[model samples]
Target: MILERIIPTVLSVRRILRADPALVKAYGGDPEKHTSLGLVTCDQDDAMYVALDEATKHAQVDVIFARSFYAGAAHASGRLSGEILGVIGATEPEAIENGLDALLRCLEHDACFYDADGKRTVTVFPHVIASLGEYLSKEAGLAPGTPMAYLVAPPIEATIGLDAALKAAEVRAVRVQPPPTETNFACAWLTGDLDACEAAAVAYAAAVVDVAAQPRR
Candidate 1:
């Protein structure tokens, strides 16, 4: 049997709505928004709870997905990108991919979260071609390749990595972890095979959770 694990990264609705007043009016609410909005004022943990609640409703469905709550205050008010990405990248690559794939699948349907103004604010997943092209140019110092090449390269690399990992392992496993905030973690999972990739992903998820559960120094 094929094992798969998923972890999702999500944004807070209250924070988003607060940032843009236009969102409030879009959801059929009064144009004259109050300084104190009740429903959307919760913190990242609250946002995660909302996202998880929504995810649970769709759990019985065949589609795959997961959700992780992120502190909008940290991202917006403070520059926590480095720290956030570090936490996320600490997880295994395979785990990240599975979670992302499931998230993408969920996104395909209308299950994505919307702001009070009804604007879709979810952007946890990255586009393959654009992401890969940017990576090659920026990191690898390679010129942009053909669209076909860009599309094929990531999966091919994934397949090779999966094959290698599977050969090293005695048994198959499913892995999952919270999505990373940095481009590095996201790109690593994208650069491998879809089938053999799950084990590494499961391993990564397990590691990430273990680390997160550990007491801070």
Candidate 2:
């Protein structure tokens, strides 16, 4: 198993309502209106990413930065760092709080990596977004309401699994994360009809299991 379900969620909020000019501009944030900040860390990196996108639809927020530490959360640089750090910005403290709440809710019910087979060691994350939210629409460069299959896994598994996913459904790969990602994983964002996206996710899960069962003889 890549990781058991003992991962804890980390969210640290700072009262930067109206934002700090020097810090905002330094981070390439606009020097305009009000803004609050939220610092988030998660054991599962890509899972938090989809939550970030979902949060944007629930609240007026922007992803300031989201990064996975080199390697994974188990070998993190410090405590509470998790496998990733995602920062978000909003016009008000209340909006920031709402966005964070939305993120937590989505993470709990919507997104997380999983073992490919029942009680197997293979790991994969295949999520089908029924409709694109503001942030995900931008990331996929598609309009809202588009269905997308968000796929992620370790390098070899992801690469091969995506190939299977593409062949299984009539989908388009809108965004592909090549090997050696920030956390040494790979990912792909596929867009298509809802049914097609779901099919692709299923195919991806199957492919991950196949890869893990490779013969080493």
Candidate 3:
């Protein structure tokens, strides 16, 4: 795991076995396989996606729901609401516990934004999943074990960064989210071999840093 990171701390955690039927239906939980729910909140919305992906790898859980709030954690609905709320469902409470462990560990260790420079406030997150987990595979509509370059940054930075990433490596653009996101960011998801995805992520980060270094021509 990478040591240098701006971690997204988890603000809250909740587990519910035998959740209300209506709530379970809304969460898309299967009664048989997803009888328990693991709900969590994090300060950064983008980081929660990574946490959920890692959670799926560690337990028999499905990411039932995840959504980012408008603005960010600074404008959250409540003190513990944070910037995003994500929920996973499993067959039993033990599976939920395992999945939660992965989610918490992920937030504590990795899946974070990085400072573009030691001085500037410019921020970026360019991540490569060597082998995507089941949750992200389903979310990205790609097969499991496929490498994914998950890139996110401020709107303009992400747009330019993704362009550089595609040009630097052989990767397919599986998804592109433009500006005006809940947190006012943009994102792109690329799929390729591990090496190619890694290259793309590096290129993305370099492009973002370049933009931070020179805002205008």
Candidate 4:
């Protein structure tokens, strides 16, 4: 029987940013500070996060092979074709066409997996495609084309160490005072992962609730 793929919707604490207080006071009264932002998982599995963390830790990474149509056409010169032509010139055209098609697929796959920010961005992996298209349009001096879609394998390693560190640390959530408007983002300092992290949040909230419930000691 074929095993079903398991994907988890992850909520990471990394995306959160701090907010300003003076502005809050100006508008009303006390500014509630927030340190971290919760990131909703784009997919079902934490494999992508684990994989990205692994790739970041390891050096000498393996090169994933991808063949672009343009790259394949450039490489398919008479010299390279000559060897195959000698064996089967009568059917050379068909073989060359097939090779070109395969090359296009390879290029498309590579384009999909191309990522710059590693784990931080891997959670929002699909966004990379749009980001790439925008980048390529500017670099290539051409109008942006509709974005292409592709799948990426999560990193081959797990991030057990990072997980352990987050669990062990006592992080305070704080809002940042604004220097720039863009700097004014909301954030929190909770652990990663949906279940464990959320459970921790619930536990913390329960403790707070319990404290409030107690009469003045």
Candidate 5:
């Protein structure tokens, strides 16, 4: 097996393994051993396909998941830029690195970006997963009857809106989903007392207008 039997899931189907990890069980093995997740961006769809093909040929790694143009926007020149986000698992750390090197070489001279986060080296799973659990929890630690507000704006104003909301009141920044294109809008979630939520909403609205008036990058 190319993956060297990393994790054993209850379901005996490949499709089920990719959809949700919550159902998967570790068979006396590390769930994230020698695993890496990456985001690759390219302006053309053809380039993305070629890169994925070459990367697999060069290294003994399992392509856990892949999706093209998942969060990419159209170019200003009216061309569709493509993005591929996927996870690679290997028996050894060197194998994963070799695979990334090969992938980059295949993408040489192309206007693309490669971002890989090595799970073994830098660990953020505990904090991230905990935050998610808290956010999704029914008894969400907040004061009873507290309200939540969502601020929606274009991508450009995402940072500004978050900053404005925090400065406006004592509110918990629940989440921020940035926009992928002009057609998509950035959304921020805030939770706090009723009066603070109202203030945060106004602040976010003002931030959105301010960003909209600025020159586009």
Candidate 6:
């Protein structure tokens, strides 16, 4: 329960998923040649954490991101407490399966899934695209065949920098990551003509510092 009460880690992999779907897809391809991703859900938050720890110790795997105890109206109604959801990554498909087995074998009803060998049982939380029109809504014709410029800063300044960057210049593609890296740093990209990208990058960097350095209201 205590583990569930803590806020979840930021899903930094989402940024990677959005930027280069093909690249990630390749990385998560055949379990025999490439790495795979896994997801595990548990009703007991503490048990999940312990199991994950044991699994990692016994198997070669990495934890992408995890969360426990997401509170909602159902919790307020006393219908539920909270649950643990975690993502694991491994270099081989067998490693993923072994890791999950080591962790979940003790549990009676373990809900575990993996992406390997033409089997995709789990949905990576940050990689789903439900609507088609939303993707087409962005007009790439605004600036074609242009280079992109990136501005990196603290996550706390994502809003300030992103707003200023878009307003400063015309851009074709833009991606903002409030928590891009493991260090919790943020970054934004502006794609357009070289001149426009440079201008937007400058505005974005300045706005981030100016906004984040200010005192709270």
Winner by TM-score:
3
lDDT of 3: 0.87
Which tens-of-lDDT digit does each residue in 79-192 have in candidate 1?
A: 322111111110223433333333334434322211211122211111122222322333334333311111111122333333444453343322212223221122232233
TM-score winner, 4 or 5? 5
The residue ranges of model 2 lying beyond 4 angstroms of the native Cα positions read 1-8, 11-15, 117-121, 215-217
Sort by lDDT, best first: 3, 2, 6, 5, 1, 4
Separate clash counts for every candidate: 15, 0, 0, 22, 0, 0
Q: Candidate 6's C-alpha lDDT?
A: 0.45
Q: How would you encode candidate 3's per-residue C-alpha lDDT over 92-135 as one tens digit per residue?
A: 89999999999898888878887775553667889888888998
Better of 1 and 6 by TM-score: 6
Residue range 1-217, candidate 2, lDDT tens digits: 5333322365443446666777776665665643577767878888888898888888888877777888887688887777887777877888888888988888778788887644635578888988888877887899987889999888888988999999999999999989888778899999889999999999997888777777241
Distance from true location, Cα of 93 in model 3, Å: 0.5
Evaluate model 4: give its lDDT: 0.25
Scored against the true structure, residue 56 in model 2 reaches a CA lDDT of 86
- What lDDT score is found at residue 185 in candidate 1? 22
Write the candidate numbers in order of decreasing TM-score: 3, 2, 5, 6, 1, 4
Worst 10 residues of 2 by lDDT: 2-11
lDDT of candidates 1 onward, in order: 0.27, 0.80, 0.87, 0.25, 0.44, 0.45
52-135 per-residue lDDT for model 6 (tens digits): 554665567655545555432123323332355555566676777777776665333321211211222111111111111111
> What's the alpha carbon RMSD for model 3?
2.2
Per-residue accuracy of model 4 over 37-110 as CA lDDT, tens digit each? 11222122212222221221222111111111222112434332210110000112333233333323322332
Candidate 6 vs. truth: CA RMSD? Answer: 16.6
